[model samples]
Target: MEQDLWSVEFTSLADAIRSGRVTSTELTELMLARIAAFDGRLHSYIAVAPDLARAAARAADAEIAQGHWRGPLHGVPMAVKDVFYTKDIRTGFGSSIYDDFEAPYESTATARLRAAGAVMLGKLTATEGVYAGYHPSITEPVNPFGDEHWTGNSSSGSGVAVTSGLAYGTLGTDTGGSIRLPSACCGLTGIKPTWGRVSRHGVFPLAESLDHVGPMARSARDAAALLGAIAGADPDDPTAASVPVHDYLAQIDAGIAGVTIGIDRDFIAAKATPEVAASIETVIPILEQLGARFVPATFPETREILYGWHTECSVEAALAHRATFPGRRAEYGERLSALLDHGAQVTAFELAEAQRARRAFNGAVAAMFAPIDLFLVPALPVAGPTLAHMATLGPDPDGILAVGPFNAPFDICGYPTITVPCGANGAGIPIAFQLAGKPFSEALLCRAAHAWQGVTDWHRRRPEL
Candidate 1:
């Protein structure tokens, strides 16, 4: 039972905790033990707060015993990316300069999760400034599925921990594909909520306009549950949207019957590997069988749109780090320093032009969604790359132009996007497909993903530790 507990999905695990079938303490300990056993090789965590987690779990167990049930997240054990500020906890932000810097206050997302009765196991590893492809303070997190394979960028440890069962679910920020790319590479379900849909109150920002906070989980249903708990406007974050928050799980099982899904075949053929293309082809028939109708569509030119995103993000990131970069320049990692150097060179006119292009791109995407319920595309162009291959790329180690174009565009448009494991390549590494929807349409996106998971076991498959 203890061994099996690690593999349980978030929803079922919550039910078990509420029903006394499992105690939060038991689950917490199990995960801690797993981390101790496996994380030396995985390097998925920056810190492990076993004492704090145990105390929280005990409190959750007492609350349930007293019949003060919180919700599905009550007594759930999870970890979050180190970018989210946790009060009194050292948040390195994957940099040596901030290695001893502890946050004075908690991020709004972590506070909400705590209120939901979730026990945080610790802080997971992240990239430098949450902008690069690798963590400079710690070893780059290894892919549990394959040692040589990439674990995706920025949210690398969040993906590793969830897939390896070190935690049930985790919060990861996506500026341009940080969340969804990891989900695709790790064979998990991840959602990048509409920009401003989730509060960025205390998160370390990469690109202010494009940053998003969302959940990475083992299944679409779990992602929906996590989104419900943390999403909504916060007075602390002026940019958080003042829109109605829907119950993401309420209609998650609703099938995508009669829903029109648009496919950009030209984009797929141009950017995707043959195996990834084949995996997407395989899922189209499966989705069609589940009653979804497919239609051909064309997206805005990828190069033009992504160039705007890059320019905007680079400039914003440079501004965010201006206090230290170039001044204390030697302190930053090689790749991040290079990026900041590039960002410092961006002219004010270039930033304004990028913003204008972004508005136009968002309009085009919104118009495209007018006729189709969702847009389906390959999440990553190929199976996960090797750390060595990524290293060779230097300053832009993420290879965004190759594996991330499908994801970055949605971030630029602030659209809700979810990536679910569709199938695996010939080597058994997972390949995923993304479903993007209109802004604030996370519930609808999860609904379609949940329906797909109902018929496929891809989301349920676990890596051999």
Candidate 2:
């Protein structure tokens, strides 16, 4: 309404259009102009669907004119990770393998978002297949928090777009923390919804069992609005849950007066870095003030999770691209290429064993949640690594643990995990807290997250860059 469109949350933008303060066309043009002016340096988008977006915006404005606003996303502009099969638009998986591949059909997610009256800005760049960590050859988007720092991979470019104001929100796939990793690194709010809660029909996969498509946004409310638009059962994906969608934004505002939060003493005292430990610990007291309860807990089967996830991820990935990897081994970078080879070598016996272990772990995890409404951990024990280092060799453990082990287990467990910036370290890099929950518990997580956000300004803070 005030024309501070870039800074306004999706909720406010919807209110503006609903009140006749701004038109969808106006916001669409603002985004396009910003993209033209800024994306040359950020490299956030692989493609800009200008004509298509304008048409959608105009259609939305006409709907508003006809007294038929769809909802919160009615005039909001959003983007997707480039790996989605966006009809008539170049939907590359940040790989040279299918660089020219364009889809004749729309993905269920894309089509639904359009039906909800959301406008598409374009396709954001991602790591190869939007799967693994760090793909520099396809795009070189800098993290919006700081140009000097590296954006987290896979959804790296999508993170840049949101933080830099190139787009309001974008869909990102999280296999092992792609969405939460970048959201944490860029100081945004992100949710990796419970597996099967969101559709993956037209999107590319990193791991079939682990991959989750969700929203990354400047605010939790914005994410909830986007989530509402894109979530639901899809006929295209047999795995899509038959659960009915609820008003996520309204749920978030309901607060966490009675939520039971579990803080694992071992994980907090063990795997966390000083920053991560500090960030997560701070959340307990804050949420307590909001009337959320804290319980100390542990996982008896924690030992089996990491190894099983590694075996499962590599194996699934290898099977997915078995034909391509052996023939085009030379095209891939070092880490992923090697992982693919090893994935192919994983025996069926080993996979079966992993599945058995996973069931045991899931049962233990479910038992853990039985005493608590949500579980809290440091999203990753460490902050983002230097792309130069991760690209050349791999991750270097500093003062932090290889904390990514948490992300994989949730994917295997098919539960929901949301990560939000708690605060930044002394160096100004963001630190995140992860909230894990039982299946289809996104509403509970969002409600709690909204309450936490109300007390903290971390979500509202922006980078000087």
Candidate 3:
């Protein structure tokens, strides 16, 4: 195995372990060391379970030596956002209220990954209750690309860990752009699988209807491997879709020949900054060269989606935190506290109207996808906004709305969307675009993204540590 194991792609690491080129213990130790050396500055982890990871790695090695390889993830070390329940490990939902709390059982996603023979590295950092900001006591993960850039929302740690090579891959939950935002900002590939596509049984909720659990990785194929391990129906979660899971990597190299990718040039131009818009424009010619077809597809009316997303997310979040919120309001952060307060005050009629609008938007999106296999857009309006800029947008409704146009609509529709690194700005911060598909179209998204990655080296570029 190479000495620079941290920079290797997830699939390559798994292959090395499977072929006896490296042992799980070796990989685990290297990752643990890297986390120790780098995480102090990055703050990408909430807790690291080195003992547990070693035990799991040893077991995996013993099994593989006996010719019992479980699958692609066998003996591979990975981590999850702290919101997922990990038995015997502190599962802080990034809140001071749960500072000393540990889960009695494991989340379905973690259990499934363990069952697939993957080694658990530890828990990654998450925003307070997976909301807009970190709890007062928690340190926000810094963007590895530049300390000044915003790390995105709740899944910032997941993005930081993978981009910084602290973990091979990670799980990130998306409600409104949590996964895609960080992936875009950090220059990683992320999948926001359709709602219910992955079981969320033991994961803390931001918004029940809007929340989605998915994988963040350096490449699309790596994401497919992670997604395959944790996806499918779970008896513990009735909301987990009963649909049969697709072998995401089976057709990953099939090429995008003749695949219709809908492009609303005006839509992207109107919503994106010049840097972002130009970067997205460059991606079209590359995809076209790979035999993909593009058509001028108009985006659906989206002004209502921003407001509906706020209403629906607020109400559901209020329900999720009902047991401890008002009683322990002081323990919460300002952003989450305000969210809960607004949610508490929303009248039934307002929530109902929000739902109505969401449904109409979903229908419009479905109709728009009827003629195209995928819809293309910038992952965020700006290439990469600075933390200073994001701070000002905290209380500005218009500013808040500016960033949601490319993100919230898909969450509202429960559609599958993937973000791939397309280009970068002058300062070398990442710029990316999104490809969204109809529900359960994750395989298509992965295939398209993988094809893009194969032809470009944008995803392979790393930040200097």
Candidate 4:
């Protein structure tokens, strides 16, 4: 197989290397070539570590050449979200405030990726502090999927990198739909594993309790591969879950048989656009043909759950930037500055009410999961809305909520969610269907996503842009 690295999946690349079809150095060089060739137009890469990546890729090549194989992620050419520190890399969280802040050590997630033998393509751009959907203040990485469309933030660059073929996949931190929102916009698959499933040690946090570090990739299978590489308990991150490592890749292709999938119709019905609605409507037969049982349900507290999410994000972000906010409140985007201000003014009583809403909402969602392996909903309310449009909330009153209302509760409740491409809109940008499962039920979630992908062409389609 003489495919360029842009179109290569890491698993396929590794297997080929194992069988002498290709070498890791060749694969890595292909990626480096692609990045060097394409990233100038996309601006997807904030930095390209040619020296470091070649070294790691060469080592992977040497290991395989010597009959030593590291792991599933071994030899994969991947990019890091700037929020996660790579020891020698100049780590900036897309904010000038952190422009020169270099860590003497590495993030646990970064360490894990290194241990798995993954090669870094350097840090990708992000919105300032991973805040708004757009960050022109720093990098101008275009969507490169649909006319420079804004993949929702804060982990904006991760989506751009993956979709633009800058890397096989990239890491992203999610507090409120950062991962899935961009995935939907950029036509990629992203997972916000139940909050603690992955370590947050090296990542800059938006909300400590709500932030999750996960992958955005070309397919659910790829996302699963990357997830397995980095997820586990990290002693440095006290909040990391102490659970059995899931064989995320093995869980795919269970055929969707005997799986009870729930269609959250009310939620789907309310936010879906004509195109998004049609895309999701088309999935019914796909699931039915797979012998999947479908249940229709709704969470009573969906609205309240969202309000609480914003409250939590703002409050936590404000707390983290206590010093910065006071010095130059102008440094933040309008949306974020206003939010942090409101969060600062939030009364204890209001916080308590939001907490109560969160509790009630989590209970409702958990109860909904009682009989279903996954809940399926459109990943975005509308597919790939223009970057300029999403930045200002445009004419859409519902805003990012349209694409990710189901996501925040997943964050608050710490549930597993994977957004896979379902279909594309008229403009040909891909739309997605999200599979959300009970907490730590990623095993079941991956199985169902794998099944869904079996008969669908969504995963096969790529943006022409």
Name the candidate that leads on lDDT.
3
lDDT of 3: 0.89
State every prediction's TM-score relative to the real structure: 0.97, 0.94, 0.98, 0.94
When 1 and 2 are scored with TM-score, the better candidate is 1
lDDT of 1: 0.88
Candidate 1 RMSD computed on C-alpha atoms after optimal superposition onto the true structure: 1.4
lDDT (C-alpha, whole model) for all candidates:
0.88, 0.79, 0.89, 0.77
Order of candidate numbers by TM-score, starting with the best: 3, 1, 4, 2
Which regions of candidate 4 deviate over 4 angstroms?
1-4, 133-136, 391-403
Lowest lDDT block of 10, candidate 2: 392-401
**Candidate 1, superposed: residue stretches over 4 Å from native:** 391-398
Candidate 4 residue lDDT tens string, 1-465: 334556645665667767656766776787788778777777777778889888988888888778888866787888888889888777878876676787878998888888888888799888777765444477567766666466667667788778766688889988878898878777787898997999998788778878999988887788888888889898988999999888888767656787787886766667667777778888888888888888887655577778777777778888988888857876666656766787798888888888888888778778888877778877777766776555666322145454566667688888889888887766666778888877787777777777777777677665553
- The model with the greater lDDT, 1 or 3, is 3
The candidate scoring highest on TM-score is 3
> In terms of TM-score, how similar is model 4 to the real structure?
0.94
lDDT of 2: 0.79
Worst 10 residues of 4 by lDDT: 394-403
Model 3 clash pairs are none
